[model samples]
Target: MWTIGLGFVAVLVIYFTYWLNKWSNPRCNGVLPPGSMGLPLIGETLQLIVPSYSLDLHPFIKKRAQRYGPIFRTSVAGRPIVISVDPEFNHYIVKQEGKLVELWYMDSFSSLFSMEGESRTTALGVIHKYVRSIILDHFGTEPLKEKLLPQIEVFVSKTLETWSTQSSVEVKHAASIMVFDFSTKSIMFSYDAEKSPMKLSEKLINVAGGFMSFPLNIPGFAYHKSLKDQKEALTMLRKIVKEKMNSPGKHEDMLDQAINNMNKEKFLSEDFLIRWVFGISFATFEAISTALSLALKLIADNPAVLQELTAERKAILKARKNRNSILTWEEYKSMTFTLQVINEVFRIANVSPGLLPKALKDVKFKGYTIPSGWTIMIANSVLQLNSNTYKDPLAFNPWRWKDLDPSVLSKNFMPFGGGIRQCAGAEYTKTFMAIFVHVLVTKYRWTRLKGGNIARSPLLGFTDGLHIRITKKSS
Candidate 1:
C-alpha cells in the first residue's frame, strides 16, 4: 500500500508539472518572448496587480522589461499575453488596430464594458463609430469653440469656489463631486447628488480597483467585488434608463442622444446603453479626478514648478478682456506652459494601463511570433517612464516637455491612448485639466494637510487620501 501511494504521488507531480507548462502556448513554436507563464490558472496576474507606491512604471512591468527586454510574454490568468514596452512595437500595435489586432480587455474589463455575442460583434465596428460620432457632435471642437467651453469654465470655477469654503477637502472625493456634477449636466442631462445616479458613480470607483486584478468570482477577491458593484451599478442605471425611456423627450444630454438613436441603430439595446453610460461615467470621473489628485500633490511638493505654472496661468488671465471675463477658446489655446504642466501630470499619473488588443492573426515583431488570439498589452507607463526618454523620469518636472520635438513627443506621449479607437474624450480631458490648473494656480492655492502618499495597484490611487486646505488667492 505504501509503494502504491508513492507511485501515485509521483504521477500526480508529473501531471502537475505538465499542466503548469501546458498553458504556456507552445504553439508559438519557441518564438514566444522570454518570461515566465507563472502558475496554473492565476498565472502572473497576481504579480501584475502587486501594489507599487510611486509615480513611475509599476514594478511588475518594469522588472519584467528589465529581465526580458522590451517585449515579453506572460500568462495573465491562464490567458497568454504579449506585453510590449518597446515604443516602436507599441506604435506598430496601435496603428494596426483593425488589421493585426482588435480591441479587447481582460474579463475584468470585458464584463463591465463589452456587449454580448451579436451586440459585441456589431458594436466593435460601425456601432463603435456611431458612438464616437455622437460624442464628437456634443464634445467635438465646434461645440468647444461655442458653448461647452464656457459651460465647463463656469462649472469648474464654481466648484473650486465651493472647495475653498470647506475647512479641508479630500482631492479624490472632491474631484468626484465636481467631475460628476459637470458630467451629469452634459452627459446625463441633469444631476442631483442625492439621487441614485450620482451615488452610482461612486460605485464605479471601487469597480475600477479590480480592473487589473486576476478575474476570480470568489467572494473576497477584488475582481468579484468589482463585478458585484458593477451589477449593482448597472441595476441602478437600468432603472434610470427605464424611467427615461418612458418619461423623456429627446433630452439635451449625451445619454438622451444615444437613447434617441435606438431605432436608427439596431444594436443600441437597453443593456448596451446601460453599459455605455457606465463606461462613460467611469471614464469621465475617474481619470480626471485621479489626475487632479496627483497634480495637486505634485504642485504642493514643488514650489518652483508651482511658481512658474502660476506665472503662466496669470499671463492667460492677463490676456483676458477683463478680470470678470471668462476664458476664451483662443486664450485656452495659448497656455503653452500650462499644457506642459498638464502633460507632466498625465505622464506621472499614468491613469491608463495601455491599449489592449487581441492578435487577429499570428504576427511577428522583432523576431518573436505572437500567436493569434493572444492578448497584447501595450504598456504606456513603461514608455512614459523610460529613463532614456525623460531625464529623472520619476520626478514631476513639467519643464522636460519644453524642448521635445512635437513629432517625437507624439510618439512617446499617449495619455489619451492612440489609433482609431483612441479615447473620444481626449480634448475634453485635456481642456478640463488645463482649466483646472488655470483655476488652481491663478484663483486659489492649496496646502496638503495630511495623507498624500501615492500608490498603484496598477490602478493609481492615494494611500490615505490627499487632503488639502484650499484658499482664494488674495489680490
Candidate 2:
C-alpha cells in the first residue's frame, strides 16, 4: 500500500508539471522574449533567488541577460513574468502605470504586510487618490519641516546618547529600533501597549522580511510564521485604535488626523483605520532602518567618503547658534555631499529592488507581447547596475555624482520608482534618514566591525545585524 501511494504521488507531480509548462506558453504572433522557464511549477524561482539571498547581483537574470539580451522571460513565485533590464523600457513602463499596467504584489507580500486591499498598489481610481493625499499630508515636505524634523532630532539624539556608552552595538538592530519607535509615535501617538518597543520593532522587521516569501502556509515555513505575526501585530494596532478613540481629547499624530477626517457617512470602520496605519508603518519601517544601517556600513567602509560627509555635517552644525539647536530644513538640504552619499548608498543597497506591476491588457512593447494578467517586473536594481548608466556599477563611489547633471541622474535613477504608483513615502523615508545622519555625523562617529553581511531573503537588508562601535567626536 505504501509503495502504491508513493507511486501515485509521483505520477501526480509529473502530470502537474507537464500541465503547467504547456499552460505557461501559448503560441503568439509577436513572440515572447528569450529565456528559459526552469521547470514547470517552480519555474526558475529557486535558481533566481538563491544567489540573491546573500544580496548578490541576481545571478540568474544577469547570466541570462548576457546570453539572451536585456529583456527576457522567466517565471517567479509561480507566475510567468517578463523581467526588463532595459533602462528606457523600464522608465516607460513605470511612467505609463495606470494606462498600460497596474501595480501588482505577491500573495505573501499582501498577507505579510496585512494590506489586503488597503495599500496604494491594490487601491485604484478614487481610492488611490484619497489614500495618497492623506499620506502626503502626514509625511510630505511641509510636515517634515514643521513636525517630523524636530521630533526625529530629539529621539535620535536621546537614543544615540545611550549608544555612545556601549562598547559595540548591532547597527541594524539599533537602527530598526529607532526608526520603529519614531514611526509608531507618528502613527499611533504612542508606543506599544502589548510589547516593548524594541520587541515590537523586531516583530515588524520579521514580518517585513517575510513579505515576499513563497506564500506557503505549512508549519515551520517562514511565510507561515510571518502570517501569524502579521495577525498579532494588527490585533495590537486595533487595540490602540480603540483606546485612542475612547480616551483621546486632542492628539496630534497620523492616527488623530485620520480619525478626524474619516468619512462618517460611509462608515469607515476601525478595521479600515488600523489597516491604513499598518500599511504605511509596515512598508516604511524596514526600508528606513535598512537604509540607515547600510549608510553607516558603507560610510565606515569608505574613509574618504566619511571624511567628506563629516566635513559637510560640521559646516551645517557650525551655522547653528548652539550645540543644542535642532537642524533646520535649509541646513539639511544644504548637505550636498551628504545627499550624494545617501543617494550612493541607495543605489548600492538597492533597497527597493524591483517594482511588480500586472499587465492590465495584452500590452505590446518593442515587438514583444505580454499577455493579459501576466506580471511585468521592472528590474530597477538590474537597471541601476547597468554598465551604460553608471561608470563602475558595483563600486561605492559617491563622487560619481559630483559632476553628473541632475537631469541625467533623474532620468536613470529610480530609488523611489516612477509614475503614479511611485512610493508615497519616498520623501518621508529620506527625511527620516537625513535627520538620523545629521545627528550622528555631527555628534559621533561609528566604525563597522567584522561579521556583517547583507540579506536579500525578501528584500535588501542586513543579516545578523551590521555591528558597529560608536564614539563621540571632539568639537
TM-scores, each model vs. reference: 0.91, 0.86
Q: After the best TM-score superposition of candidate 2, give how far the Cα of residue 224 lies from its true spot, in angstroms.
A: 2.0
Which ranges of candidate 2 are over 4 A from the true structure? 1-20, 24-30, 52-56, 105-123, 190-199, 212-214, 242-251, 264-271, 455-458
Candidate 2 lDDT tens digits, 1-475: 9999999999999998778767567455568888777676677767755535444466776788788988888887678888888877887888767666777632222333232445434434444566677678778888888888888889899889989999889877777777877777767766662365436666777787567677677888888889888888888788778887776545477787667665431324576677776777777677777788888877777889878877887677677788577778888788788778888878877776688888766778888988777788887788667667788888889898888777777657778888777777888888888778888887897776765677664367655667778899886
For residue 296, give model 1's deviation from the true position in Å. Answer: 0.7
Enumerate clash totals for all models, in the order shown.
0, 0
Instruction: Give per-residue lDDT, candidate 2, residue 78.
Output: 73
Model 1: residue 332 alpha-carbon error in angstroms = 1.1
Candidate 1 Cα errors over 4 Å, as ranges? 1-7, 24-26, 105-123, 213-221
Cα lDDT computed for each candidate against the true fold: 0.81, 0.74
> What range of 10 consecutive residues in model 2 has the weakest lDDT sum?
106-115
Clash pairs, candidate 2, are none
As a TM-score, model 1 comes out at 0.91
Candidate 1 per-residue C-alpha lDDT over 1-475 given as tens digits, one digit per residue, 9 for 90 to 100: 9999999999999998787667665567438888888877778888887788887788888889899999988888788888889999999888886577778632223343444555433445666578789888877888788898888888889899989999999999879768876776777764466664447667777787678777989999988999999998888888878877776677488888877888777667787777778878888888999898998898888989888887887777676678768888988898888888888989888898887889878888878899888899899988788777788888888888878778877778888888777888888888988888887788898988999988787879888999999999888
